[model samples]
Target: MTVIDFTAFIGRLATASGETILPFFRTSLSVDNKSSNDFDPVTEADRAAEAVMRRLIKSNFPQHGIVGEEFGNEREDADYVWVLDPIDGTKSFIAGFPIWGTLIALLHKGTPVFGMMHQPYIGERFSGDNGSAHYSGPSGERRLSVRRCASVKEATVFTTSPLLMNPDDRARFGRIENAARLSRYGGDCYSYCMLAAGHLDLVVETELKPYDIAGLIPIITGAGGVVTTWDGKPAQSGGRIIAAGDPRVHEAAMKLLNA
Candidate 1:
């Protein structure tokens, strides 16, 4: 197959998602519970956003497959797939926190080659494909690259919600934080945006589905960052993820994880 122009498609998709998500930012959404815990919440906004994106994809790229957080999978055997995390921070969106956003990524043969993280509430879109990462905001487009946070002790660590982790996962993350300079919470896919923007160093988390990590791959890789499972393996298959600015930092953290 010819090289698909991912940058253009992702940018258009991001803009389309913005149109669907912006009005509902704080305008009273129909929120729902995904489980007994309020921390695992969902909203009509999530479904509606995914629906909007799915329609766009089906109309324009009918041959492509889609795996969406809300809608499950469609056409899994297609040569290319789109993974969509519509409103990744659903808990934040339900709580009116404005920290939520949509994540979109294109996978070619189970590998991410393009990604977009669109924060409609904040009017920011971070995207990359074809070996380039850029952010579109009020200041126009700016190139992005990960910062060289040389060591774990000097690195910034981000995990969206510690409450989402089990005891074993929490302990694993704690062992990591105990060696880090700073640890902060909030932002789901948006945290990866921070990493790609060079404003953050590392992101570690567990129990991620494909949609959760797919959208960060291209942006992170394009920014000259490393993203993988804790064992320093490919993240596209989805599991525990650790994204770092430096390869050395990644290896050191992986050692701690496997230890």
Candidate 2:
């Protein structure tokens, strides 16, 4: 299918997921512990949204595989795969924080070709393919590009939360945070959108799975941002990801992260 054709499907995917999720936002719903430590929270909304998307995919593009946060992979070996995180920021969602959104990505032969982050509550959508992004929100629709802030010292940084990091990763992140002009926490996927919008300069996080970062790469890169691992490799599979709005800042941050 052409890029235009796939984008139409992406739109429908976002809408289906959002409809399933909005019902649970700010309302009482069941929360369960999925992590072995009983700390990683999953809610009914997360599962319902993913289920809705999966149904849509199975109905429309039955050959395309799916990798989701709530449900395990299905036909992952398929050349065309859809990576999904229905509630990318489950913690934020449960906390009534608006920073959470749904992440959707289309990967061809294991490389992401399309990505989108949609927040139905705020009526915001950020999407891209390759290295370009477009945004739609309460204001209007516009193409986005990251602003240049050529140095790390002039940069503003963000991470989901220090608490989410292990001791070692936290220490490593601290070095970068210490170098940035300002460091804010608790943005989840929203901060990545902010970076794409040119409001933030750097974002570093560890322990992310493919579903977490897959949908963000295009949005960030499309807006003239760079996303890579801590050591400066492609971030498609998501390990320790560091995204910088400027290449120089990304280089500097990588130095601190690796040092």
RMSD (CA, Å), each prediction: 1.6, 0.9
* Tens digit of per-residue lDDT, candidate 2, span 110-130: 988899999999989999997
Candidate 1 residue lDDT tens string, 125-236? 8877738788988878899989997788988989987777888888888877899899999888888889888988889988899998888888898898999988767998
Return the TM-score for candidate 2, rounded to 2 decimals: 0.98
Give every collision pair in model 1: none
Q: Model 2 lDDT vs. the true structure?
A: 0.92
What ranges in model 1 sit over 4 Å off?
A: 1-4, 36-39
Q: Which structure among the candidates has the greatest TM-score? A: 2
Local distance difference test values of all predictions, in order: 0.84, 0.92
Cα miss at 26, model 2 (Å)?
0.7
Which candidate number maximizes lDDT? Answer: 2
TM-score of each: 0.94, 0.98
Give residue 172's error in model 2 in angstroms: 1.6
